[model samples]
Target: MDGATQFAVSALINILTSLICITLSWWVLQNVRLDLFLRNPGGIQGKMLQVLLSIVLGHGLAVFFIDYLGWSGMIGQLF
Candidate 1:
């Protein structure tokens, strides 16, 4: 493949990755809220807490996974 083909492939991969990350985050919130709603059927505060917790947990997991994937690339630099 030539330069143009390589660039297009890379761009496509990047776009797909971004979309997946966003969708996963949304899923995290949606599913958590659903559970919370069922558990606390009459509590407004509980639902609010559920949304906040989901956002925090989702971001934490995202950072953790990114760092783990980057570990191999970083290993040799400190050697």
Candidate 2:
């Protein structure tokens, strides 16, 4: 109930959210043009960078839209 406790809980939630976001992103990308991506069948090296980029970008985009859209939607909110 204290400041530290709240911070800890918030941090945990953020971590879980980011993890879920990354996983969701990877799954989506895997299905998208999967045949082309896996034409050579990346064993380990090829998939690693793609996975990392997907996670970082996925969480980043989510944060951007969530924090920015509410402000950007002011016109729609008026109508």
Candidate 3:
């Protein structure tokens, strides 16, 4: 493919990965009861923690998915 086509495909892949990561993180946060470990689950600190956890988890999962699909090397090769 040409450079423009390759760039478009790469952009789409990135967007899809981000969407998957957000969905997975949101599902976990909504279904899991975090009160088990947190002192105040609904407090500001707890919410901040939740956001941090979600971002970390999402990034990890996204990386895992990309690696599992053998796209990690492709990304490195592309850029």
Candidate 4:
């Protein structure tokens, strides 16, 4: 594939991975008991906090996976 095509594919993969991870994180976070830490877990602020945490955690996880895949692919160069 050409450079542009490769770039597009990589971009698509990164976006999809980030979105999937974010969704997974959001779903998993629903089980956490935020009431223990928050005065009102059902309030808007609490919900915002959950969303922010989900994005941060999901992005971190996505970066890790993407980096791991890239590094593993590079292993072939060692031969």
Listed per candidate, the RMSD to the true structure in angstroms reads: 6.1, 5.2, 4.5, 0.6
> TM-score for model 3?
0.70
Please write out the lDDT profile of model 2 over residues 6-67, one tens digit for every residue.
87986776677667777778877776654465544476755775787688877986676545
lDDT of each: 0.63, 0.70, 0.83, 0.96
Q: How high is each candidate's TM-score?
A: 0.43, 0.62, 0.70, 0.97
Among the numbered candidates, top TM-score falls to: 4
lDDT of 1 by residue, 1-37 (tens): 9999987986775556555565577676655536534
Estimate the TM-score for candidate 4: 0.97
In lDDT terms, how accurate is model 1? 0.63
lDDT of 4 by residue, 1-79 (tens): 9999999999999999999999999999999999999999999999999999999999999999999989998998899
| Top candidate by lDDT | 4
Lowest summed lDDT across 10 adjacent residues in model 3 is found at: 66-75
lDDT of 3 at 64: 82
Error of 2 at 32 (Å): 1.7
- Count clashing residue pairs per candidate: 0, 0, 0, 0
